[model samples]
Target chain A: MAVDMTQKPILVVKDLNVHYDTGKGPAKAVNDVSFSLRPGERLGLIGESGSGKTTMATALMRLTRAPGRIVSGSVELDGQDLLKLSDKDLREVRLRDIALMPQGAMSSLNPVMRLEEQMIDAIVAHVPNLKRPELDARVQQLLKQVGLEPEVARRYPHELSGGMKQRAAMAIATSLSPKVIVADEPTSALDVVVQRQVMQTLGRLQDGLGAAVVLIGHDMGLIAQFADTVGVMYAGKIVEIGPVRQMIEAPKHPYTKLLVESLPGIEVKQALVGIPGLPPPLVNLPTGCSFNPRCPFAFDRCRSETPQLQEVVPSQFAACHLYPDHKELPPLPARATRELHA
Target chain B: MSKEIVRYIATRFGQLLVVVFVAVSVNFIIPRLLPGDPVQTALARLQTSGGAANVDIQAVSAAYRARYGLDAPVWQQYINYWGDLLTLDLGVSFANFPEKVSTMIGNALPWSVTLLAVATLIAFSVGSLLGARLAWPTAGRGIKSLVPFLMVLTSIPFYLLAIILIYFFAVVLKWFPPAGGVDTTRIMRLDWATTYDILEHAFLPCMAIVLGNVGFWALGMRSQMVNVLGEDYITFAEAKGLHPRRIFVWYGMRNALLAQVTALALSLGSVVSGAVLVEVIFNYPGLGSLLYVAIRGQDYFVIQGVVLMLIVSLAVLLFIVDLLYPLLDPRIRR
Candidate 1:
């Protein structure tokens, strides 16, 4: 689905930095990240494990616990800065204006509560004066909207299949018709067919509610199928971000290139090549660009200085020194650049 | 309510029956195996007191055995034991001659039940609340410091606490009576005055029990609360913007209390046995003191009766707990 670029974004996150005090030292989990989502737009956040995608999602809602904190950031929803709001006001905004569909459907819903009870809790937390019948009707409607039968609401989370649990989570998240929903790996625990069903349900829910979505996952293929725009992360930084089609077809960042190349294709017979090195430690990141240690295209400039995310194409942005506009620096080697673009 | 639940209850009841039978049989056999004879002991006590020394010892001994039915064969005694049990005849207490075993227990049972039940309920309620508070991430250091202190208190045996309390409150302060369930010298009426005196006398032993047990409940509940707090659903609850108080009670304590309920049920089931050490220390006329007396005097009938009562009561309590389990935890229903 297409979203109008002229519309004011429903959620704007600017320079979010989250750090964890791990006793040994501070580990930067999310470093200087910024993105925006227009209403009904699906932004996929794809990264390797521990690359801060989940951390970023938690920080957006101010859900980071002690020992880990949002060091600095501005998460503005509908022009109101969430970070500046008191906990009381933030809770008012949480489900009524923004909601989260968390990871691990099996553990995300209370095992002791019925699905309807959980949904009603979310509803009544925001709309306190609603009567029981009205609340029950709302829960049933949400369950139906998520492709679940009304009777499914009566069962506890354990009784539901993995797919049903994910769908129930989606139902609760969208129950209030919040303007933005952050879904972190909603389909990670399901089989392929159920994954497709959950994704489609998520798509339908987002479209129906006209809520912007930030879908976080490690599965590139799943992200590609659903994300209107894709952001590739390495270590704790977004290395490249662009329109999904453009980024997949022509990835500019070295990390994004490796990610795109690593997608296994059933139609095309090609041995999948993995990225060469582990993501740099968050505590003691490599000297220059976070991705430089593993980048085959890294040069002396890549090791000495960090590259800012600059527009490489009309709409795509990348953080690699090999991109044009680094004055007096030699261009990337022809053989390496050729091999990447091939 | 359902066929499956009914089946589960029936199975549990059957198991309870087996346990009760085994316990009753053991109660009958163990006292018989003891080396000393109760009738002989009684006669010796009379002789030591300079009374009945001139009487014919053999003739009296034969008459006593016949009167008490100890002259029957062992197998017949066993059969008669079951027969008397079915008819609710616990024979007569050898220590308190001519007094039925049932009457002695009947008099003592209420005091123990009242003391332990009130103390346990109070301890569980207060401890669980404090434990839930301590488990909160933002709980202050002052409250968190109670964990180790409470742990030390739990490690101290109930009897030790009883001694300490007795020394300070009874011996030193002289604020309350030193021992006994109630003052028999006072008018034994169901007046507020009598009730107040009974409670006043019960204060130290009850406090000792409460202080010793509250720590365990707090520790159990705090660990469970900590575990529940770490669960993903708690995070979800927070993300849902539920009130913090609601989150603490519904999301945190509700789930944490599941394991604790089973613990509470098991502890309560053993309440009939009474806190044996504390009772012995306080000289409280509860089952624990009764058991101690019966053992020392080799009062076989009294011992058998009390043990049987404890086993039957515990089995009944457990049966009720089993019925209530699925109600408390829905997962167990299946």
Candidate 2:
């Protein structure tokens, strides 16, 4: 969907903090994080496997479970603070204002119920007075919209392929045409072929509904392909976020730069390169920057003081001290970047 | 039902027939295959026990052999046995001569079936519900307290539990009969009073079975439910804005029950064996008690008849489960 940048953000997240209180201490799964999504915008949040992208997505829907509490954050959807809504109102708001297309497509639908029954359940819970014929029609329309055969609604989940299952989930999430959809790694459990199909279906559905989406995944290439705005998350924080083009061609934050460069160019025949050092433990992050221990350009100041997201270029923000000294990120020294095979 | 389900049922019914045939054949062949002739053994035992030294042994043995058709050729006898089984003519009880074994079984079958089946159904329902609630996040402390109590219940044998129940309710409280199916003094009648008396007499034995088996079903269901609650669909169901109750029942308990049903089918054999001990302890007039009394009294013909009934009933129970499983899970319908 072509994002209307001038439109006011349909969903706003402010100072969101979700932590899992372990015996050692709280694992800050989602630290103080904030972002906004314009109407019909597609924002992709990318990170390492445990970079809290999922935590952020789930928090937006206020579906965070026990031990992992949303300590203090306001998820405002269409001016309604979802965090503060009563349980009933919060429940009503979900799937109507904002919905989650869960990560595990293989298990998203109830195994015991038919696809039609599962879809009808979600619709009936929100719009209780709808007649059975109307519900059936809605289910058929939804199935057809997802490019599924009408016969699919009568079949169980086990009967469907992986791509079909993901499409079915998409159909459910957009059943009410919710203004915001939080898709947490929607294609994680699929093969590349099925993954592309599911992603394309999701994009088409988002465009059809004209609803903003927060697409969370670890794959930089996949997310960049679909997102208008790209956010790189590290240690539960959004380290950088900007237009996808700038974020890919000229990444500002050292971590994002290292991440972008790590992707082997299709034209090159060189071995794969990777960022050195693992992601810092969430509970005990580095003294200043969460990425300082892993950054190739970490200076004395990087170890002493944490940097907030600052505008390095027009519409492009990066959380780093390097932005102050240079107009653009300098090339990484040869020894700084780790090459896997060499 | 669709043709797939019909085919599934037909397949299951065929398996039931095979199992019944094997059991009936085994019951028929094992006795005849014994090293010594069963008629000769019965005659020898009767002579020794009855002190009938003056009676002619040959005449008595021949009469007994002719009475049960043991004097016929082996193949003819096997055919007659099959014919007799078809007609429910299980011959006459040795201990209670002139009373047909089928008549005795028919009299006792209803009591046993009602007592055991109803108690088991109640236990399965109550236990499964309790287990689901226990695993549920919002279930109160009241239900949580049941875990340890259930563990304790599971460990104690049912017969011992029956004795303890009889002691408390019948001996201490004088509220129930400690033994027997009904009061021998009361003439049996078709009325509310008779029904109430039967139910009252059934209470301790029923409680013994229910209390004994409930813990197993509850524990089995709890683990299944825990795993089910962790499934992705449960979270999706919650995200669908569906009420927690709806999620708990349809999304949680319904899926968990597939495993519980399989467990119920596998445990039916043990349930029958366990019933034997409970029936003997309560002196309840059922197939189990009949088997026990016949064994103790050396009533060979009555014992054989009761055993065949038990085997057939068990096969029928398994067939019912086989039919039920596909209804619970469509994946099995194929």
Give the top-scoring candidate (DockQ): 1
lDDT of each structure? 0.85, 0.89
Q: State, as a TM-score between 0 and 1, how close model 2 is to the true structure.
A: 0.96
Model 1 lDDT tens row, B240-278: 999899899988998898888889877864444447667
The superposed Cα distance between candidate 2 and the true structure at residue A48, in angstroms, equals 1.1
Q: Candidate 1 residues A92-197, lDDT tens each?
A: 9887888899898789888778888899998998999999999988988888898999899889887898889889888888988999999999899999999998
C-alpha TM-scores of all predictions = 0.93, 0.96
Please write out the lDDT profile of model 2 over residues A1-342, one tens digit for every residue.
Answer: 677778999999998999988888888989889899998999999999889988888889888877788999888998989999999998899898898899998998998889999999999999999999999999999998989999999988988988899999999999999999999999999998888888888889898889999999998989999999999999999999999999999999989988988888888788888988899888888888889988888899999998899999998999999977799998988877788976
TM-score (C-alpha) between model 1 and the true structure: 0.93
The regions of model 1 sitting more than 4 angstroms off are A326-342, B32-75, B265-274
Clashing pairs in 2: none
For model 1, the local distance difference test gives 0.85
